[model samples]
Target: MTFTQLLRKENDDIFQAIFNHPFVDGIGKGNVPDKAIAHYIKADFEYLNAFMRIYGTAISKSAKREDIQFFNEQIRFVLNSEIHPHHNFCDHIGVGYEELQGYALPPTADHYMKHMMYHAHMGGLGETISALLPCPWTYWEIGQELMTKYEPSADHPFYQWISFYADESTGEITEEMRNRLDNIAEEASVEEQKHIKEAFRKSCQLELSFWEMAYTCEKWPGKEKVNS
Candidate 1:
């Protein structure tokens, strides 16, 4: 089996939890609260900023032009294409997309971004890719599942959000990422392979937490205080 397939199979339980999460269920039914949707839009907009930085780190470590271009292209996709869903959500909720840029990363998002950045800065290409893979890969899976279950019409409140991730383009890009991770794994040291597996699993777990975070509109505990 391909490394990516193996990762998915091993983590099937986590994927199932994500699939069954109430947040995802709400999106499928077009009934999620506006507050929850707004929270997600703000958190994810900040999260994408860190996602692009991880890709930038990968590009800096790349030796081959093809690898560099691959990372570069995905960065462009996140900036230009993946962001459309955020804009749509903002528009639906009557919030300005630009305002979301000033929001702080919620607790779960902050930890997830730190996890990704650590791997990008401290690990090899294989490890970095493994760490980054779950975000897009699982989104593609979630998108496919939502589309199959709901077949949302154009007038559905979340139709644009759902259709954006379910698109052929999203699947194609996700496939490209998986293939690249598999190729990188082929030459990875045995120890590195272990790290790769751990990274992939941890990232998958974090993806599930992200859904819960949005569902609850998670935030840092307690208010900040100024010294007297």
Candidate 2:
């Protein structure tokens, strides 16, 4: 099996939990609370900003022009294309896309962002790809699964969101990422491969936490102190 496939197999339980999570299920059924969906979109807006920076970090570490271009294309895709779903969600809820940019990163998002950033800064291309793969990979899987299960129509409440991730183009992009990681693994040292596995596993766990965070609109434990 491909290394990416093996990683998915190892983390199958987490993937299943994400699939069965109420927040994801609600998206499939089109019954998720507006508040919860809004929380998720806002936090994800922040997350995507950080994601772009991590890609930039990867570009800096890349030796090959093709690798640099690959990261650049992904950054452009995220900036220009991937966020269409966010806009669709915002329009559904009567919020401006720009407004989401002002939202704070919730605790789970903060941790997840830091995790990716840490790997991007501290590791080589393989580790960086490992840290980054789970977000798009899992989302693609979720979208594909939801589409199969619900066969949502265009009029479905979350159809745009669902279809965005489930698009054939999205699958292609994620497959490219998997291929890149596998190629990197072939050159990775034994210790580096272990680190790559850990990074992938941790990112999977964070992906799960992100869904639960959105489900509950998770917040800090106490009120913020006043500057006064």
Candidate 3:
């Protein structure tokens, strides 16, 4: 099979796993506690910002000028659409506009950010997408699961967020990404295939930790501050 096919298979596997997760139900129903959701949203944006800084620095230092410029533009587009608008999540959860940034995130939170930096430094944009795709795509796939397993409505936050990113409303997926996956597949050796498989698996495993960490911090006992 081609690399594109294999890449799709890998994404499918991860999405299926996430869709079946009990936590996914909370996401679908928008049943997640507001404080927890707020914290997660803030943490996610901070993480993305840090990731871009690392990636931008690394590429500028080593990549050809044109390639660096192109990747920077793509990353800018992603951040502008995905991260900035997502900040309004705090307001949805009853927090003040400035309060979200002051919230202290879990210490282990940087693992994903650092890993992304390392990957971008080593592998550039295509590899960067390989590492990044699991999160958004997983959610999109889980939305499908939620739709299949439960009734849908306009008020449901699950449908709101999922549809925002995955459906025609947002147009998150791009033809460039499709071509990149196809090219990677066409060029990959057996060893590279193994590496890609492992990277996808590792990325998923990290994703699980990411969710679990947020859950733990919010649910932790005897905490004086709830939102931070």
Candidate 4:
């Protein structure tokens, strides 16, 4: 199996919970609580900043021009166009965009972001991609599947979230990202391949925890790292 496929299959249960999580299902039905979803958007908004930095780390670590180009493309989208609407989503939830940056990092989020940065700093191109894959890839799959299965109403509260990831271009970008990871994986030794797969599985599990964290509306504990 390809590393992606292997990772997904090994963690099928987590993927199932994530894809079918109440937070996800709630989006389709517009049944999610305002405060809970708001907390999620805030956490995700904070997470994206770190995610963008990790992509930069990947670009610097990569020797391949195409890989660099791909990471750059993601970096541009995240900074320029990708997050504007999400900030608006935060506003709708009653948190100002600027205020979100000051909130303490929820435990799961801090742990997950640290996990990603470590791999980006310590791992090679393939390993960085493995560490990064589960978030976008899982969202891409869920976005496509949920919109189709549930066909959320036009006025669905989370319509934009459904529309963005479910869009055709999003799928193309996701496929391109996967191809880049696979290309790098082809150059790795067996031991390195094992490392890459482990990273993929760990990230996938983190993705599940992220969803759970959001669904439960876990607030920032008294002692934890602040979002940067």
For model 1, give the RMSD to the true fold.
1.8
Q: What is the TM-score of each candidate against the true structure?
A: 0.95, 0.96, 0.74, 0.89
Runs in model 1 deviating more than 4 A are 224-228
All candidates: CA RMSD in angstroms? 1.8, 1.4, 4.3, 2.6
The TM-score leader among the candidates is: 2
List candidate 3 segments past 4 Å from native: 10-13, 54-70, 83-88, 102-108, 124-126, 157-159, 169-175, 218-228
Model 2, 1-228: lDDT tens digits are 988989999999999999999989888998887788789898998899999999999999999999899999999999999888888788787878777676778999999999999989888889999999999999999999999999999999889999999999998888988999999998889999999999999999999999999889898889965454
Better model by TM-score: candidate 3 vs candidate 4: 4
Relative to the true structure, how large is the alpha-carbon lDDT of every model? 0.89, 0.91, 0.60, 0.79
Evaluated at residue 29, the lDDT of candidate 1 is: 90
The residue-level lDDT of candidate 2 at 206 comes to: 98
**How many clashes show up per model?**
0, 0, 1, 0
Which candidate, 1 or 4, would have the higher TM-score against the true structure?
A: 1
Query: Candidate 2: lDDT over CA atoms?
Result: 0.91
Model 2 CA deviation exceeding 4 Å by range: 225-228
Q: Per-residue lDDT for 1-228 in model 4, tens only?
A: 775566668878877888788887877776777777777776888898899999999889878797789889998888876665576466457767666664556789999999988888877878888888888888878888789988877677677877787887777777787887777777889988898888888888889888788889886757655455
RMSD of 2: 1.4
lDDT of 3 by residue, 85-146 (tens): 45445545666645666444465557777666666666644566556555555555565567
Question: lDDT tens digits, residues 1-228, model 1?
Answer: 998899989999998899899988888998887788888988898898899999999999899999899999998998888878888788888888887675888889999999998988889988899889999888888888999999999998889988998988888877888998899888888899999999999999999999899889998889954455
Full-model lDDT, candidate 4: 0.79
Better of 2 and 4 by TM-score: 2
